[model samples]
Target: MPSVRRALISVSDKTGLIELAQGLTALNIPILATSGTARFLASQGIPFTEVSEYTGFPEILQGRVKTLHPYLHGGILAPRDAESEAELRKYGIAPIDLVVVNLYPFVETIAHPEVSLAEAIEQIDIGGVALLRAAAKNFASVTVLTDPADYAMVLQQLQDRGEVGEETRLRLAQKAFAYTAFYDIHIASYLHSQHAPGTFPDPLLLAFSQMQSLRYGENPHQRAALYRSPLPPAPAIVNARQLHGKELSFNNIFDLDAARALLQEFPERPTAVVIKHTNPCGVAQGETLCAAYCRARDTDPMSAFGGIVGVNRPVDLETAQEMGAMFLEAILAPDFTPEALHLLRKKRNLRLLTLPLEQQPTTSPWELRHISGGVLLQESDGPGVDPSSWRVVSARQPTAAEMEALLFAWKVVKHVKSNAIVLAHAGQTIGIGAGQMSRVDAVQIACMKAVLPTAGAVMASDAFFPFRDSIDRAAEAGVRAVIQPGGSRRDAEVIEAADAHGMAMVFTGRRHFKH
Candidate 1:
């Protein structure tokens, strides 16, 4: 087959546009591009025909209708076969062999702290989808590039063979299809969140754009990458810039996200969470931000070593002084005082990030898991537990001090990996058991690790106990009270066990399983 002769170039992220355009021009391919892209090409001394000249129509609607013309679509979608070529010639259409296109600045535009509704709506692209689909549909004969990361490989293939091969073309086509699908999912999610619901509903649409391929996962053999949720522009996992330290692994990213999400929940309050292996090692709230950090650090001093710490309030000098005494992998806060930043900056290996706390938290609609062959999806179990409606089911109602500890444990337990158990006394964690196969096992592990079993400790379970056996175990370990979502059929047996042991138990009517 003859080499691709015509290429269209358009992009918002112009990372490798010049290099790619140069390579295409070197191969004698005629480049056609939009107004800004065409001007850029001209400035760079790369030859290109304006898209309007090729399509015989000016860009209208303030550039919204630039690439939406049938001439552009017909060229990209036209097959290279004799009949398709004859038909295109009959209709005055030229075959477009390659499409290098990226959508508008939707992600950046919506990420602003106070973006208006009309401004957000305007960021969504129309012609970009048409260009992607047209090129992707004719993948057998055309190459479509949507990501800047693919530029190097595509240029290498074109350099070696004067054109991208069929295999490379197919791979690019697959990427284009997935890219467009994710983009549409994001638009659907945004519209649903902003508009009235119809009879046919897309209740949940969660899409992530991969930020980077990591060195490996938790284990070096497993592959992983940091991914950000589409288009909303929260200072989420994907957007976190690593200021220092080594490359982030899968476990690090997981733990960081758990800590960050919990911090977002209490932006107006002074709160700190120390997370290890995607579970809360310690979590505390206090009057001052420094006090909160100190309390959280004291909760599990040993476990906090090399763990991620997240703060809801600004990090002050006092907090930084305390943090500098120990080692940490990462620290995230809404902001940091100048003195605090100066002190913390001395620890060059620590990754520090400051995020603008959102006025209202964006809730995820569904949870997803990728199996070997497919993916599993379900609704998100986001903060379903109501604190005010909880009932004291045990014979002995919890004292005020015990109630405070229980509430603290309740929030910490929800973010821990299941099957999870947390033991707290006063305002700190005494012991924690995480990622066990059984609930009873989790209880035993936590109790075994406790510094003082009889220290007026309260227990928090991530989910309802399937049997009263776990409650019995907690009672034997001198647990004063238990907090758990009471949804199991045998909840009566569990409550009776607590009562028999003269322990206070609260049923939250909600379960937090963090697997």
Candidate 2:
């Protein structure tokens, strides 16, 4: 490839601009920069020619039309063939060997709570995108850069070999294309969301940045990587910081996310939950973190082994000591005390992740699932639980204690798989049955899985029971109260069965089916 003879620079993010320009100038490469970049370079004592001076036309439209001229695009898009060379000379265009540009902060501008649509529209970049696409298209002869971190590497290569290699140029071109696509996707999504708030667009566009390549996928033979959404960072597993432990596996990430989702249900209280294979084995809330963890684990100690643990509050020394007794795969929390960290660090292979404590957990507007042919999207279940919407269906009303346990079980059952049933006493779950084929089978499994006594335990079902068999089974297991989304065609039969068994039942009128 030919050495870089001239470069064009127009960027909204000016990080490392001066240093890159100086390096290029040191190598005897002339630079043509737009007015903003030229002003910055001139102030920093770096020499560069302004774009208007080279194009022989003043910038119009408040600097928006600065780099959209043919003189600039022609230079960047020209190939290294005789025909292209003749056309370049015919138009008095000097070939541009490098293009460095970063788009305006459209994402950042829209992130503000009170930003107007006109303000966001003004930040949607046109000239920068055009320049990047033109240079990236001619990667055989041009090197395009959209990231500041690449400046040093490109500069080093030029200093060593006096020219950028084809491989590096190709990679940079790919990155530039991705950068522009990401920018455009965000702009389109924002505009569509504003125009039609609760409806899906005809052609959906999603953009994600790869966070890491996992050692393997759910299985050893499959390949996998983790990607983060393009939206602003939030307190989620994707944005969590790993303080100690070996690299996380794909299963560990999945279990940790399940634990985090459950923990989000009880943000105001000190809670701990144990998860196994994306299902909650035990969940409990207590006045203290250690007590909560112990109670949660004690609910089903057999299933708690090698499980992922999530805590709503910071881990203290007491909780860490209690956790150290178990062979846990990972733990996710907001923060950890120094003493707690010191104790937990002894388990070298245990993954410890921390999220931002100041921000509450947030749910995405949509839930997406992938199928064989395409994808499915729907509204998120929620971050809210309103017991006031429930109606007492059975003749007997639940006591305050039973009501509390019923609500606790209801929250936990939402996170469980389909055909889910949870048995709870006090504020801790005593037995859980998830992903069963039948509701009666789930009830029986909950009874059999109980480590604590099931007598007086309240039960929660993710959906209505189609028949009275589930109610009979739960009553046989000593359940005193039940909460479910009551929508079955045989609702009268189910309610009569509950009344006959002396069980207090509440209908939420909302089903939570997780498949």
Query: What residue runs in model 1 are displaced by over 4 Å at the alpha carbon?
Result: 1-128, 136-175, 187-206, 232-235, 264-269, 287-290, 336-348, 356-360, 436-441, 452-454, 465-478, 487-502
- What tens digits encode model 1's per-residue C-alpha lDDT throughout 473-503? 8888889999998889998888889888899
Candidate 1 local distance difference test against the native: 0.82
RMSD score of candidate 2 (Å): 1.3
Query: Please, what is the whole-model Cα lDDT of each candidate in the order they appear?
Result: 0.82, 0.93
Query: Per-residue alpha-carbon lDDT of model 2 for 208-277, expressed as tens digits?
Result: 9999999999999999999988563356788889999989999999999888778878877789999999
Give per-candidate clash totals: 0, 0
lDDT of 1 at 436: 92
Listed in order, each prediction's TM-score against the native is 0.75, 0.98
